[model samples]
Target: MSLAAAPFTSLPTPLPAPERTKTRLLELIKRHGPQTAQDLAYKLEVSVPAARRHLCDLQDGGLIESRTERPGGRGRPQHVFALTDQGEASFPKTYSGLCVDVLRHVQQLFGQGAVMQVFDARSAEIAARLQAEVPLSAPLPVRVQAFVRVLCEMGFDAVLEQDGDTWLVSKRNCPNLTVARQFQELCVSELTMYQTLLGVPMTRETRIACGQSTCLYRIGP
Candidate 1:
């Protein structure tokens, strides 16, 4: 199996050395499944002792576990590291199952209109907070920058760009993706919120809930 470590750009910058190594270790195990300490050390280019130390820490933190495996069912035993449930959750996800369950209950109790109202209220609340943080009277580009900043703060992997005369805002990660899949009213509420906040017409080109890689919105003329 290829032991090449994949590039991860989403890790927060300026991570401390030991923490960075541990995080990478988790990523490697997550991507490659169970890996021997020797393999992890080789992949990380760290000494076996160092790798073992990190593994111990992860095990203590309940992120990874080790199991003894014998090569060819007869060779000497070696330990392999695998991610625990906690470790798997360290990665990003599009939606929350708990949130989905709560929404299901809400729908069952109050009907679809109430669900729509929930999203509408949520959109308004988020829009109000963003408006307070990013002045609506500011220039469109400035507001766009603030919008992206606010989205990032709220756990959305959002970016802003200028496409000729138009501005494009793309969200690469959705914090409530699964919820949106079940409640498309969430997407509609989002568009309405953006227009209300920007005070300009906007169009959604693609939706993550609709199977697109990104939720793309086109703003400006």
Candidate 2:
């Protein structure tokens, strides 16, 4: 008997009927990074208003977010919508699992020292990139703002907010919470990173790992 070769696979499987339009729209956005309603309309071969309606429905469901884009020599700034972390969840991912496994193996094979070194090295690299954007000579508040933007762009769901007299820098959602919890060193490195980046008196007001709602840091004298 002759053996057959393995079958080819396609992403996300497929859906039928009314779900098809929404699913296809999401997939188009996912494949093309971010796109405006007009662009999405052209891609989907649907009218611009219809595309906007679909996008509105998706945004209402918390699948995407609208960001204002200032084009060069533009008549007006336009809004481009992109998938939020929640929206991206509809897609497949393997990186997080692989990262945890790799770190665990490193700790087991070498030692906790090696794992700490890994985190430290990673933090150092991140700090360098952040410093380039924020500048070390900038004011503490300015530096905190820059770092918050960087964290959000890196999928940390970070934001800087003012709470009464304090400026609070918080990561609303931790991208690597599981790995950080398991390693613990990751958490220490994160605090050290903030201190090194901001060059000001900062304290952790709350931490997600410790059952707090948000991972908050107080930045000021």
Worst 10 residues of 1 by lDDT: 92-101
lDDT of 1 by residue, 117-174 (tens): 9989999998887787778889988888888898888788899899999999999999
Task: Mark the 10 consecutive residues where model 2 has the least summed lDDT.
Answer: 13-22
lDDT of 2 by residue, 1-221 (tens): 99898897878866774467778789998998778889889988989998888888889999989998766647688889889999999899888778889999999999989998999999999888778887888876677788888888988798878877668888889888778667788988888887888777688878887778799888876
Q: Cα lDDT for residue 220, model 2?
A: 74
Reference-based TM-score of each model: 0.58, 0.60
The alpha-carbon deviation from the true structure for residue 209 of candidate 2, after best TM-score superposition, in angstroms, is: 2.2
Which residue segments of model 2 deviate by more than 4 Å?
A: 1-90, 163-166
Task: Return the lDDT, model 2, position 36.
Answer: 88
